[model samples]
Target: MLVTGVKIQGRADEAQWVTQFKVQYSNDGNSWTFVQHTNNQSDMIFDGNTDRSTISTNIFPAQVTAAYIRLVPTAWHIHISMRFEILGCKECKTPLGMKNRDIPATRIKVSSRGEYYIINSNDNTSTHHKGGSHARLDRFHYWVPDNDDINPWVQVYVGLGKIVSGIIIQGFKQHWTRHDFIKVQVNGSIFESINANLESTWTHDHPASHATLMFEKPVVTSVVRVEPNDCSETTRKLTNGNQIVILDCALRMELLGCGNIPEHGCVKPLGMETGDIQGTQIRVSYNHHQSNESRLNYRGYWGGSSPNINRWIMVYFGYVVNISGIVIQGYEVYWVELFVIEEMNNPTIGTQEYAANFDGYTPVTVLFEKLVHTTYIKVTPTACHNGYCGVRMEILGICDDNSNP
Candidate 1:
């Protein structure tokens, strides 16, 4: 994307900020594409920021070949002299002059490699991550914007020497697709643009109106292709077609490949939080906020690592009225495994993602049938990388007011 107008009439070296700008994109969280003023082409439309100078910019569609996009600061600032504002975005627009309070234009900070970044809509990539992309099939990769006219491209891979059995492609997590469509394919086949909602007389998990593409009796394939299609499958008040906003995508396969749900593709061992260090895993609770660390009280935050081959820890404890459900807040979290123990003295076990495809700005919540009664709740990182959770969980109880557990 070409930059609109930027000028630092600050004189001499003071005009440093106008030197460069950057935009970035991300599909599965691993690889990234960055376009900036550091390029060979010079597209700065404006030379200086005057009182009534029209401000604007261009969005090269080619840059965003993934799920989400964001605007970040590309040019390095040497001193406190660099300061300016970007204007005019054909793809993403905000309030013209003065204050721009739109959601997409909100300033967000991202961590890359090992440093912090403050960015806006001018950049093309998002730093939001749910603990690394390849961590699990159940977790979600969310990218929300005010406008759906824009399509985000996402790439799915099978790594190397990986094989798997059947695969199931589901939408909205709970809704299953009869066919197991691959996220990434062998060849560079963008995606099947047309979306098809499932026909009736189908199996459960099929929405009253659902969209499913299941691969029964399927073989192992290296790379699978998944992209956004413009068409939609409008049926039975259910639009499972690919046209949805695509908050997240859940792939179910065996081995390194994706796995379908209900049908446990690969069985792997998980971890349990022994009450030794953090006490018993009676009931784990947490909450999330824009400025969370400052909003809530916590020891710290940590994410998970890998999938299939990882173990998730569960905290158990005693409480009154048993338990109802669990909630988590996060930027990008692939998937999470929930667990509960009947008693602190007894052993606690791991549970598959009772909830899958968790995404968006709101907190990620999932309800289960298992009854929980404890003072301790173990929280462990399973899929993706290792680090802090997106949202702090608040392990809601049957009763809202009292922590009478």
Candidate 2:
């Protein structure tokens, strides 16, 4: 769909100075209704500027029935907004309404999460490519040893924000030494600590450096810090000198989507599966390499077939707006399977499994999730009947700013 490019001048250019905005719409200009009322995250909107940020794209499959669109700035005290058309469409189909749900906005915050990021005074923006752990959502995000004597460190402070309850920090820990340690401290006071030597440790000692940090009961003060006591003994813990760290903050910030693979800074982790079938990737081919090729008909195996080792896996994100659909790139085979589980750790008889959607040429983005939840997800491809095939897939959906995951 094409839009005439909206330009919000004056205070709309900054969101901090703006609080709420009223959005209205019209199908035939004869009937108009209020559609959305949003409280901006920041009141940065300033005066005397023609800068407009693409706020949110709620309308999906843009072809849906609508005639005109407009936004009324709260700062302007003007309920009257601008007007725009539905591009080529000329008919109104549905009533004007807010497409998003009325759930309370999510919030997550943490202080002194001791995983992923390394906080040191050595930060030099000019020292680009200089590797170290980084923090996000008030927690550390990366622990990979991308630098000499690299260690994951982070310092966080969640100033007593209103309505804050607590914080949760989770991560994977690999034990390089028999006495591996993971600690948590809050308000300059040590709360709890764990180590490989601890009887409750569920993992065994591996050369890999896998560890998690959770500093609970933070003071909600204006300052905090955390770092490895000394990881030099875990020198062999470096898995390619890199360790991926993840933290879920539950107080100050919602889990925001780390946009497009950053061109610089740290590297991005590629999907466990995203490549040609078997050529430098897990291959997807027919196991029916028999003299009587007719015995390996693909149509006959529509119901089911031999289990191929080319297992399929995907990371789902819940609450993402504009993610209308997805596409997969693989051999144009119909043998797509989806295994949905209720929990990542456990599966039951109620687990639901369905076949995935495959385009005639490649696999379309499988609509395997309405939102990202580990409750359940799995994939199995159908028989190729012929040979290993090459593929590249793409997905298209509503592109907006509201990233809820």
Candidate 3:
């Protein structure tokens, strides 16, 4: 079903008006699920009048397939009555369906090992094997517990609650056995054992190296844990005497609904320029550094001189776009003490100036009060600390071209 528009009829004062409302759908009419409304990761709303309001067509871009759709008031001025117009069609396509909705995890912890497993104890020079901290699910490096307990598990924290659809687990391949039987828990729920084995040959490059467990329906949760069952027995022996029951486990999870499209910096260096810098490595944007530090090999944009005040770098996106926020990642040596972000309608015309306060060598996000439409953004460091000032920056904005905006 396509939700064409919404007509809200209510009488209330300005303080009692219902401004924000979220659409909830239910297939069984008893249990309801929230529908994703906008790219800003918020539900749909009817803003403006306090008494009566009529929303036009295509108010909800997402396709609604529930038997019942209810408008739940989140922020309201008073009691209200709402009428939703449902337009029936063969199919309703939403922008969310056009993009991948895999949510990134903020932290991944193992029940036995914290985050990394040190291979050698004496020299402390051995490779640090990451259990669940690594982003890639297919990597051979995995987390191994001290003992092969029957309930060794790995948990992923998405930081925020999200609707998840499936979970993928990759087991270590020693001689033959792969982690076939496991238990899954969502948000401290009871552990449900599942036999997610792919009956295929155990080769170095086999496609069945990983097993995926899909839920019957989407599950709204922030934490997911995968525990090895009794069936997951390994013959490999540890340095101690106990037999290894659990091997290296890697995980990859997917969300049910479409996630917000991330705003990326301009790839083409059309009108990108920086102030006087030290060397030739001046361009610092999304392309300069990798998302994670493990894969980051290149140094970020570095200024020519030592840490000084009033150093600046400007970038033009080629066209006008609405920017919501900016992210800056600092290096280990030098970082910005105080910085100013200025939006420009033209290359030479500067608009409003926003000051950003953050710590050094850490990634910080500075959000604007409202979306600013501009073609140029200039980042000027008013103060710095440590050594030479350099940073990797990203512009979070509404793209005019793709499904992200």
Candidate 4:
């Protein structure tokens, strides 16, 4: 379908009309692309109905062809209520063949978990467990790992390559809000992170439910791993009268993708894990006495002199290239909670701010709105987690020989 525009009618109540909205299109309905204005290249916002019975219609600057279209309410008069009609011409019919379902327990694999917190078992028919370790909703809840596993992960294998758009993760039913930050890995390498800190406002009617994390780009892979970086823990008494502490708990998971891999499905990482980058090229404004600035070890990272503002780490890419994003990981116990990137590609562009990495292990990938072509870039840590400034990162995007002029 070629989606050309949208027609919306507000509710009978005049106070419940939507004032502004933005449209987004998706091929699989899981990953969405925003409709942009040709003039500004920004998300196109449509002026909505002001009264109850008025039908407001807004046309798109350019037609978008997709399987599904959604309207996001940007502003509302009092409450958001609307009846929408999609305007489009029936050209080539796009079938809704995407299958999104929970990955079976048999295909799930965890790094390590508690004795009663069974993960790999295929017994999901019953919601009740003998030890009362299962949630009322399902048996897949509460994957409590041992306290020794600082960073625990749950992996899913789909037999063959599938185009994965996202994953659904639910928190423990008995616990409050957990899983603030989680990293997604496709195949064997880190892909991205669920940057949004998800937490349910527990209630009888609205209990803790799953949060769907959509990727920036769909990945074609047979295996996908999810690791919870920062999950708060609580000591619980087991059925055997033993009290144990669970670390970085993940309750339930579901894969969100179906269909064969496309020809261009995956994006390759630029130079962090592949060793294409040298250590000596990295420069730091201030290095901690106990840390090395040039080491890329997972256990070790570049730490600032003190957990203070204005500390920075710069990387020289040898040659200019169109840099897109970055993946930053923390040291053993030191990590930066907030930082900004200064791309030397354009001096007038200044710095772009980003906040991530709730823990010291899982890498947080931050994407940029525009491509940065620069030979060197700097990152300044504005906020540190627990007053520890640590960082290790990899640059994303391809290096172009023609860009080195």
Q: Estimate each model's TM-score.
A: 0.26, 0.25, 0.35, 0.46
User: Sorted by lDDT, highest first, which candidate order results?
Assistant: 4, 3, 1, 2
Model 2 Cα lDDT, one tens digit per residue, 48-87: 1122433322221111124566555665323323222122
Q: Which has the better TM-score: candidate 2, or candidate 4?
A: 4
What is the total number of backbone clashes in candidate 1?
A: 79
Least well predicted 10-residue stretch by lDDT in candidate 1: 261-270
- The model with the greatest TM-score is 4
Question: Against the hidden true structure, what lDDT does model 1 obtain?
Answer: 0.30
Q: List the candidate 2 regions with Cα displacement exceeding 4 Å.
A: 1-25, 32-54, 70-311, 315-324, 329-334, 337-355, 358-392, 397-405
Q: What's model 1's lDDT at 142?
A: 23
TM-score of 1: 0.26
TM-score attained by model 4: 0.46
Q: How far out, in Å, is residue 300 in model 4?
A: 1.4
Task: Residues 288-327, candidate 4: write the lDDT tens digits.
Answer: 3432343433456777547455678777877776565566
lDDT digits (tens) for residues 1-405 of candidate 1: 112222232224453333234455566666765643322443322222222222222223111223434444434335323343332222211111111111121122111111112243454423433211322233343222112323323333332112222223333344332342323332112122322332224343642232333322122222333433332322122242212222223222112222211111111111111112222232233222222221111333323332334333343433533343444434444233332333343344444433321332223333333224445444454432133343234443332222352
Ordered list by TM-score, greatest first = 4, 3, 1, 2
Scored against the true structure, residue 39 in model 3 reaches a CA lDDT of 46
- List per-prediction Cα lDDT, in the order shown: 0.30, 0.28, 0.44, 0.58
Give the range where candidate 3 is weakest over 10 consecutive residues by summed lDDT.
Answer: 262-271
Using lDDT as the measure, the top candidate is 4
Better of 2 and 4 by lDDT: 4
